[model samples]
Structure formats: C-alpha cells, structure tokens
Target: MSETRSDSTPESGRTVNRRQVLARSGAVGLGIAFSGALSELFAGTASALGRSGYGPLVPDPNGLLDLPAGFRYQVLSREGDRLRSGEGTVPSNHDGMSAFAGKGGSVHLVRNHENRVTARFAVPTVEGITYDPQGKGGCTALTLDHRGTVVSERVAIAGTAVNCAGGPTPWGTWLTCEETEDRAGTNGYTKDHGFIFEVDPVDPHRTGAVPLTAMGRFQHEAIAIDPQQGIVYETEDAFEKPFGLFYRFLPNRPRGGVGSLRAGGRLQAMRVPGVPDLSSVQETGASFDGIEWVDVPDPLATRTPVRLQDFGPRGITHAQKLEGCYWGGTCVYFVSSFAHSTEGSAADHFGQIWRYDPAAHRLTLVIVFGPDTEVQLPGESPDNICLAPGGGLMVCEDGNGAQHVFGVSRRGEVYAMARNRQNIGTPEAPEWGEFAGVTFAPDGRTMYVNCYTPGTTFAVTGPFHG
Candidate 1:
C-alpha cells in the first residue's frame, strides 16, 4: 500500500557511514554555497548558528528506531493497540500531525491517519464526526503529560479517505487534507474526497466532519497559513501529466477561530509568468518576481481539476510531488518532493524547498537537494518538514533506499537525527517505512514523529540544542 524501495544495502554501523558520506561530499561544517535571502531567512531562526545537529545516530538494540546518543524515543501508540477511550484500535498510516498546549500541563496532538477503504484498522466512526460511514480514513487525538507520556488517545474524526499531510492553524486547530480526488462510488466511497477538514486539538466535539470545499479539491497534500493575513497556501501531490499547482485560499473571515473556513473563501492558483513547470529551474537562488494568482474557475472540480483548469494564455504553474508546508518568519515554506523525467517532469532532482514572500510578492528557491545516489543522506525526497525548535529544519524522508529523519542546520549542514531500523520484511529482504508528522511539544522539550507503516508514534527527548 505504502511506497518502498530497496536500493542500498542495510548497514550495521550508521555513525561511521554517515560521517563518511558527509566527509566525502565535503558538506560537513561548510556554509551553504549560495548566499542571499535564504541566509537571511535562516539567520532569523535561533538554531541557524551554523552548528551541526546532535552528532551521529546510535543504533537501537530493539531493532526499531535509532537516534542520537543521548536522545531516546518512547513508543506512544502502535497500530493494533487499543485507544485509551476503548473505542477502536489505532488506525494505520500515521501522517501529518500538530502539537498544542492543554490545560494542567498537558499537551494535545491531533494526528492524521492516511488510510483508505482497505486499511486494517479504521478510525472508529463516532456518531457526530463521521463524514461517510463507509470511508476508512480520518484523524485521532492524543493527550500527553509534561513528561511526554501518553495520557489519552481517541478518534477525533472518522470516515474520510487518504488523510495525508496537513498544516496547523494559527488559531490552534489542525487542517487535515485528503490527498485524493475519488468521487462518490469510486472504490466504494460514499462521498467526494480531496478536501481539507479542520480538527480541534482540545475539543473533538467542536470539530464536526465538515469539508472546506472552497480550498479546491485536487489531490491536496499540505497547507501553510500565513499568520498575518490568514492566506492558506496549499500544495498538490498529483503525479500525472500536467503535474500539480500551488494554491492559496483567501478566507472570508481571515484569522477567525476554528470553523471559520467553512464560511466560504476564494481559491486561486499561482502563476509565474513564463515558469510553467517549477522543476525546470535548477539554480538555487533563482527568483521569480511579479507573481500572479489565477482564480480557479472550478474549485470543487465538478468537471475538471484546479490544475487542469484553463487560465487564459498564461497558464498556472505546476510542480511534481508538491508536499510538506510550514509557515515561518515572514514567509510560507513549501516543498517539491523530487521530480523525474521518466515520470513526465520537465527536469529531474531529488527534492526542493521554496519560500513565498507574500509581502514582497516574490517566490524564491531556498534549498534544492541536488541529484544524489545516496539515499541515506538528507538530499532524498523530503516529505513532511517543520521548523525545529532548537533551530534549523527537521525533515522526514519518503524517498528511497533507507528512510531517515534528518536535521538540516542553517549553514546547510545535514545530520542524521534518527534512522528507521524497523524491518517490516524478512531479515534477508528488509523493508523500511517512511517517517511523517515531525512536530515539537509546546515547550519544545519533546519531539513527536510517526513511522508511517505498521503505524507507530514516538515521542523523542534528550539534550536538544539549536
């Protein structure tokens, strides 16, 4: 069901191998070669002081997740485990997640389950929150103490499909996006999919099963809301011809609290004049000014996808595998998780990070992961990403070979913060799943991430430094 590849052989000692990779690439301790707005952006973050992340990863004896020496992870929930509410088992395909502060030193996490109709465990169909009884994907809410121990876990929303990566709102709610365009009766689905649903972290009852249809329905991957104007920037993960387009939803109520998005909004796709395909740009510092926004003729895609909608002569810009989005500093950062010529892309690359400056009306390439054969490094296709509390960025690998959660410093130094040693296959034919939902506690003391297969959630803590 989930994607996996076995290109590089599994190694025993990861520290030596990681160090050797960095040394050979001449990337250790060296400042990022390109200097401009990117340097200024990293400089604003506290962790961008050019310090390498918490050294090499130490292999776990349990053959699960490997982390840095001082750091350790606690299993919060597993796929087959019964939830604290005793309603149903934890669902499979843990994806996008967000952490919020709760009363009495508790923290609330609203996590997404990227499950479809055939998933083994579905988010229990709660009466009021069930959107479609036959649908088998949704979200769950987890409560943790200050010590990062799970206190309560329960279904927050149920009966959706393909609950993939989503973004947290400034008003303390999580916008879960469905990464599918399945209409009613497609694969037994009772309703249309590919819409964003808002979930409340503190109160599940407030988050009824409501789809913000104004956000445009076309294989939604992730969203980042500009805290200033409440403009929601979204990424599409379509892998077919014509690729996917970047979108921004201008909400009617702006930064209003949860459920405000349902009031209605105007959706628009981005256009960069001559740049029809984003992957064609290879240079790191390439800038596109005078950006334009084309109104999506049909946001609901009743007849056509938003990306495929005609926008006069100057068509909307599209990119391949657009995923992972976060709001930081004064811009909204989004990722393009690699492109391939064989996959019908204009150009090829491992991954790319782009920053859109709403104030300046400019879009700039921040970080570009060049073509590399080593899947063990950070240059692999980075899926879910977050601005690390200790500085820099935390990335989840969904690429090839081995899977890892990598730390990229402000100086462009890459370090392996954690590795996936969970072999879901035979010893002779090992299989590793991708990492998703990397976020931090409200106090920044603990980090929470999900291993997407066999569905495991972990809370990692230690001497974290920026």
Candidate 2:
C-alpha cells in the first residue's frame, strides 16, 4: 500500500520513492532569465583555458559575485576543447561541480553540460551517449589540483538523459544525477538516463555511465547522502502543475557508505505525519516554499513512484522547488528557485532557501529570495549551495539571465564571491547567471566555480572574511 498523510502516524513509517537535488537545471540562456522555467521545469551551463570573466575588482553596493581582494581567477576549460583523457570534449553548457579536499590536492569534479541539441564531436570507445540526436547533456568527471589546474578529465556519466546538478561524496566520489524521465519508450532514446550515478575520482574507467535505479526514477535535481546513517535524500525536479515531492531513502544498510546505498532499502516521501491538512497543497504549478511537511509512506519491497497528494489534504501548503541539498553539521539545507506555483506566471516566481534539521525533525525557512535579502542582491536565484568549511553557507545564484556567487555569513550577512558575468555593479556585457558548481579547498581556503556555458572552471583564493 502507498503512504499518504491521512493514515500517516509516527507509528506507521510507510514506503515512498524519490530523491532531492540541490543545483538547479534547465533555466539559463545566453542572457535570458529562465527563472519562469525554474518554477516550471528549468533547463539550464560555463567556461575558462579560455576563461570569460577575468581581471580586476568590480565594486557593487548591490554586491555581485564579490571577492575579498588581491585574489585572481583563471579559466580551466573551454566550451569546445580537447580533454586530457582525449575523449569527447566538454559538451554545450556546463553546470554543477564538486571539489575534493587539499591544496595541490587532486580534486574530482562532476559537471553538467546541458547540450539538449546534438552537436558534432568525437566519441570515446568505452563511453556511451543517450539521445545522441539531442546531443549529450550529461555529467563530466574531471580532476584538478589545489591551485586550480586540470590534472585529468573524462566523461563521468555519459549516454543518459538530461544530466543536471550533482554533488560529491564524503568518501571521495561524485554523485551524478539525471534531471528528467522524458524518454520512457523506445523512441525515448536509452533507458539509462534518470538515476544517480557514482563516479570515481582517480578513475573513470570501466564504471560505465550506469544509473542507480534503486534510487527511483523521475525528475531528479540533486541528491545528498547522509554519511552517519547512510541515508540518501533526493528532490524531484518537476514543473508538473501542483509541484514536485521531496524524498529520503533509508538504505538496507545503516551506518554504511556510498556503495551501501546501491543495496537499496525503504524509500519515503515527506508528509505532515500527524496533520493531513499540513500536507494538503493545491495545484501550485511549481512550489512549496514554506508549506509545513507531512509524513508519507516508507519504501516497501513492492513500491513505485507515488504522487504526493496521498500524504495529505489539497490546500494546506504550497509545493516548493527543491534545488541544492547539502548535509550541514546537524541538518540538511536546501534551496528553492521560486516561492509559490509558477506554473502560472512570473509574479509568483521568486525564491527561498530552507534548512531541514534531522535532529529536531523540522524544516525552517533560512532565506527567502526577492523578499528583503534578495533585494540587496537583485536577480539572485539561489541554487546549488555548499557549507563553507569556515562557518558560513556558500550560495551559487542560478539566475534566469545573469548569475552571481554569494557568501552568506553565519550571521546571514551575504557577500559576493565571483560573478560569471563581466561587469559587477554596473551594467555588464558577458551576462552572468547560472553561477554554480561551488566548493572550498580541503583547507577551506580557496573556492572553485563552474561556468556551464562556454564550459570552464575557476578558482578563488585569499585571506577571506565573508
């Protein structure tokens, strides 16, 4: 039996299946703001060895991708370049990325290239390509040193569907995810896209771009694995009228590792457990920025992708867009691209950030874009996020048109880190939006960013203050 809010009780931990994604996808174009799509189903890319945003400091009382000072940046990869592995070069637009610990340390990163359209490129022997006609919009795993240099690179997971935002594993691996399940039938390309894939940092050979179906299939954004409990948390990326659902998977093995997640266990969706109404959400188009959560069923041996309505009523809360999800200290913090249902129009489209504390088992609103905080930073669409090893939260702005990187201090004081665009405060030219793929050096000193379009990597270092 499926789970819903009506019969949900602390005693009954039913089964449901889903995942959460932090970095947003399908929402950027040259200089166009794809935000409306974020509320619906954003389709979103980077560059650098040919980098785009370079040179000196730009002032911004408005604060756009600001840095501490005395720090410089460089381009590591270009939109069309040959990889060290000598495989297929970077596809169209590049998205999300992860950094491993250590300076001069070899870091493994998985980037999203939203090449929805097919292109002319050389193919590798061992790799695969899905929707070859749609081009190859998947994740690429590459390695770099501490000082910001590409050591080695390869297609982490190829031949899948729309490859979107993904994160790194605590155990030294990358979790690459597919953003949609568009091709379901034979004509739908390969049956491979739409699952989480684990990529090797030092090695990309033989691991074939495989999808972990045990993680369920639908529209996936980003997923975070809880090292302590070996639980995988995921968010469904949907513009399906009402909104998408948030999920958590309890692997068969507790206190396990990433490989253990493949073992499978109980998959559950969220609901307000005791309050059915708390679970009720109307056709919000694409949202739930602050609607309270209701408890749903747990993943059972005989379960499948279940809609959220069973968990509660119909108008209690607004379904939200779940982007980035990182395991911070004692809680899981995620961001939403918009506030309410944007399946309707632009007016209801804004953004919000939230924190889910497993300890107290509560979801609280941390920051709301466009409401006060965002005003300080216009066009700020909070997407893929990382916890600063120092003491703050690093937020990558995935905007419709221009994107910026922001450093929100522990005290909620937000500062600009790096901008994908050329000019900062003044009207810029290079158009920066989709500022994502952020991670700190193992020492928490330097930061690396990814430019999906043009496809490039950047490094930021300095005596920082946030």
Candidate 3:
C-alpha cells in the first residue's frame, strides 16, 4: 500500500513503477514569476501567535463550537431534523458544502452527507435517477437569511456513495463527488458508484441527479475549476493499495452556463519532469517548474485505475491522500492530507500544501505541516480548504486528536480559529469530531461550516479581516 523514495537520484533511464529518472536531476530552478509572486503575496507571517484572527476562543458552555471574543455562531441545521417536504430525517456525517445567493437576501447552502449503506438515515428514492437504490449518501439544500436564520430545507440529491467533499462551479451549481469506487451489485449497492454529480442549487428535486462520467471514475475527494480557461482540476483521495494522481479535465464544449459538464471532457494526469513520481513531502518552499500533463487513455476505468494507466515512455507521478483543492488568485491550492516516510520520495509529514500555477506550469510548496507531536495546533492534517475573503486561506483539520477549523496565512503561518466542543454520546464513549464544509456567504458577512459527526451546520458572523 505504501512506497518510499531515496534522497539520491535513481540511475539515469531507470524506471520504477512507471517513474523514469533522467540524467538531469535536481530541484527545479525557481523563476521570478512564481518566486517573486509568492514572495510578494506572502510578505510576512500574518497569523504568528494567532494575531490575525479575532483571538483566543472562549469555551462554550452549551457544548457546541468555541470561537473568539466577538465572533458568534448560529446552529442552522442538525441531524434528524424534519425535511422541507417530509421526505425523511436530515442525513448525518455532513462533509463539504458551498453557499450561494438566494432571493430576498437569502443564501442557499448546498451540503454533502458522507453516509454509507449502514447509515441510520437515507435519501429518499427517486426511481430511475438514483445511482444506487441501496446507497444512503447524498446532499441537501438549506436556505438561510442574511442573519443566518433557516428559511427552508430539503434533500437535493440522494442514493449516491460517500458524498464527501466537492466544489461549486462558477456557473451556480454544486459538484458533489463520490469518494468510493465501490462497484454495483457488491455490498448491497445496486448501481456503480464513484462519479461526480451536478446538483442545481436552485431546485435539486426537479433537475434530477446527473453524474459526469467523463470526469473519470476514481476515489474523488475534491475539485477546483479555472473560470478563465473553463478547465476543471480534480484530486483523488486514494490511499493504501493504489495512490492518487492530480488531474485536469478539458471539456470539449466549454461552459455555456450551469450543468454544461454533461457534454463530456478529456482527462489528463500531471507529471513534473526530472522528479518522476514526485513525493511532494520535500523541503519547505521547494519549487518545481514546467510540470506536464499526460493524457489518460480511458477516462472511465472500471477494471484498472485511471492513475495506474501507463502512457508508454512518459509516466505520471503519484501522490498520497491527495485531498482539498481550490482555485484562487490564478493558482490551484491543494493538500496532501497525511504521509509517512515509506510513501513516495519525501520525508514523513502529517500534511502539506502545494501551489500549482497553470500559466507558469510550476508547482511550489506553500505550507509544510510539522509532526503531530509538534506543539503547533494548526499544523495538523489540513483538509477542505477555501479562499478567505480577508486574504490567505481557511483550512479544516481532519488530523489525529482534537479537530479544528484553522487558518493558514499567505506566508504559511498557522493559527487556531475555531474548535469543536461537542461532547455528545455516552459518558464512557464521547465524540471528538472534525470540522468540514468551510465556506463563506456571497455577501461576505457570514461563514458557514459543518461538524461531521452528528451533522450540525453553523453560520458564524463577526468582524472578519477581509
């Protein structure tokens, strides 16, 4: 399930697991476009000692979320709550989510539920459109007013598998991705799973579930889109047996508007020359230039994994637990959740952030998470990241121990923003759930997030540092 990489370069022209090390081998030379741009953007550490945020969080007596002095949160939705039309109880294990504009000063929150066949709650069957009748995972839509009050709530799409983390398209649609490759007729699943489905945020019930099969079927974690070029960047959250690849899909017909993904697209995996099978857990601030994309032979790989598809002479690089990707400020910010010394050609680290500049064709290390034993709380496994309105990035943690919604500054400074204080369950057995679905409202006043365990969505408002 895991592989290690040596510091010394492999013999010239030698191939290992489709990775070929060439004669010219060294750290890619840094260029001004990438080096200077990042240096200027991240001039200094903004969150050193948690100074950029509202400050230390006060313990919540209600056993909910703990935030800073001026910050306050409102519980918008919770598990087992009544649905809009009484379809069923609200699903649990909420994951990634997005907030869109609604009529009459309201915001539509499109959220995902990461439940399985054994889940206590199941999204209602819609007959023909349901991917798997036995699958219990799906997404929900909640409408909240400007003050974070719920206006309406309903199940958007249902019967999918592991509706994990996904991104919102520029054209007003939520792309919910399935993180499992579980085949149909196996384990009670009646249909093939592991595909991205587009949900119309306006009216999910009427639009019907449309899975974008051309995007490739893999252990999809998250997706990011470049609005300018109409290209979609994807991350595969595969671990153990088969590794994941960083991919980009070029749509044959560019986005005319929402739901244009049905037209199909060509998939390609990324490869950085010289550093074949690049293990991204390298030295902090290291940069690799001129990264190339290799075409994937079969986009819909049922028997063989798309990442394992060989491209003859030039092979693609494999990354461990690739998750949480976003497109912002002309670059793609992605996360490698966790990795050990045994995987790829990098040192052991809990988490890492990579910045890919499409125009420059370069990938640079942005943040290097320290060991878990380290004292820094925010330096944990950062997942489900999004661009902050007030500069820098907002990261959700899924690491070991206490989970939190931390902030990563432009200069890679980490700081604690919010913590989970939900102590529900038996006295002997308690829950220490991780935070997910971190996003901001279109108006930029309210920040919405999800607690993955019992499924509680919160709308936090305060004097943000935008």
lDDT of all predictions: 0.81, 0.54, 0.74
What lDDT, from 0 to 1, does candidate 1 have? 0.81
Error of 1 at 367 (Å): 0.5
Give the residue spans of candidate 1 off by over 4 A: 1-38, 47-49, 374-378
Error of 1 at 252 (Å): 0.7
TM-score, candidate number 3: 0.86
Best by TM-score: 1
Model 3 error, position 367 (Å): 1.1
> Root-mean-square deviation of each candidate, in angstroms?
8.9, 9.7, 8.2
Error of model 1, residue 417, in angstroms: 0.4
Per-residue lDDT, model 3, residue 373, is 41
Model 2, total clashes: 69
Clashes of 1: 2
Q: Model 3, 96-177: lDDT tens per residue? A: 9999998888899999999888777776665544666788998888987766678788878888989999899988888999
Q: What's the distance in Å from true for residue 60, model 1?
A: 0.3
lDDT of 1 by residue, 1-466 (tens): 1121111112222111111112112334212122123364575667434676676677799988998889999999999899999988999999999899998879999899999888988889998889988889999999988667788999999999999989889899999999999999999988999999999977778979999998988899999998889899999999697899998888999966889999899888888767889999776667777677777888999988777777776567899999999988788889998898899999987888888888766777767663244444444788999877745678898966568887776666566788888887788877789999999988887889999997999999998774
Candidate 3, residue 170: lDDT: 88
Per-residue lDDT of 339 in model 2:
46
